[model samples]
Target: MSITVNPDWWKTLFDEVYLMTDARSVCNEDITRLEVDVICELLPIRSQSKILDLCGGHGRHSLELCARGFSCCTLLDYSQVLIDYAKARAAECNLSIEAVQSDARSTGFPDESFDHVLIMGNSLGYIKGPADSQIMSEAFRLLRPGGWFLVDVTDKSAIKRDFNPEAWHEINDDTVVCRKREIKGDTIHAREMVLNKQKGLIRDQTYAIRLYGSQTLASLLEAAGFQQVTVRTGFSPHASKGNYGFMNNRMLATGRKM
Candidate 1:
């Protein structure tokens, strides 16, 4: 018997994209009731501020901000498929949000174009290379001085303190899986064990990701020319103190161009 397998670390193993989409809808439905409040605080959205949702997959936050009277809220993503979905969502909501397909590191926007920029939903952790610096630099270039740029990412402490490098749980009645990984300089070595639950036997799969720390990320952002880098706890500072088995849950970093 043949079994499909996951090879892409956290994204493929657990594959939380659906959860992300559902989370997006939840954030939109309740507006302020979300996991990350730091984005709102750093937005500087004065009802007239021009906002750009950088790498915004489905316009969730953009749509919410628009409802709150943001002068301009544009959704920018690299995937045309996601862009199409986002545009359709905007249309369905009767909102005139601009949806564009563009790389986050090289968005084709003029200098000082937006007053506030939001890169959220743990999207910042996906980019895994030196190019991250370029993305940060581009963010600085895209916004006016003192403009807000909010980034949502996993806290380094949380990840280091809790990342189960070796573990697995049941995915279905027919499959159970576990994985292990090791970081060696610039690369990740990984392995996974999968069992066919129905057959009461073991199957196969794997996962890997290049490790990065918050300090490494901060340096990248700083070198990109962002100033006043500030980190916040939780999804939004307004969270009612939820615990994630660690002191830091998710972190939001806000930097201003100055």
Candidate 2:
């Protein structure tokens, strides 16, 4: 078994089974609403505001915002599966949402095209080194003057206080997902295995993501040309069903283009 992860792990990690692995927070509509509520409070905007949901998987937050009468929202994600899922959900709910498949580092949007940009659901830090900073720079370029950029990420202190090496969760009566984690500098490398009672082994994969502390994240935003950067902690969301992983404790960082 290889402990190392593919640098392109993210390209294939968020497939259908990922919905099962992360069902508790991502699939739960109530949890999505609660999270969007916090987001709306942090960056209050008018209905006509043009918003971009970067790295928005399955458009969870975008869908919730549309249902709440926040139009003019576009969701961009690298996963085609998730983008299709988002489009289907929007159509089913009779809500208007634009779902696009694209990379966060280069969304190909016009400069200063959006009034607001968001990186919700701990979608940052997927790529190590300068990739995260490039994503932030893209966000800065996409935002208009005075536009707000908000990101949700794990709180490093909480990770230090609550790091577990190995854990398992029962996805259903016959399905289980097990995880093993190792820390490498500021990055966490994880291997996940999914097993089924009837079919036996389903999936075994390894992935890695860079973790950021509050101050470091704020500084990154500032370095990306954002002004008035602020970070608010204690944005934890409780799960009523499956595992939330690093989402157990998160911090919201906000900045302005100015």
Model 2 scores a TM of 0.96
Best-performing candidate as measured by TM-score: 2
TM-score of each: 0.70, 0.96
- List candidate 2 segments past 4 Å from native: 239-243
What Cα-based lDDT does every candidate model obtain? 0.63, 0.89
Itemize residue pairs with steric clashes in candidate 2. none
**How do the residues 1-258 of candidate 1 rate in per-residue lDDT, one tens digit apiece?**
222224333333322333222332333455333432345655666877788888777677787777666748888877666678778777887887888988888999999999988886556534455556777888899999889888766565555656555655555556655556554454345565656745654434443443445666566668888888877654433244332211136567778898
In the range 79-157, model 2's lDDT, one tens digit per residue, is 9999999999899999999999999999999999999999998887778669989999999999999999999998878
What 10-residue stretch in candidate 1 is worst by lDDT? 13-22
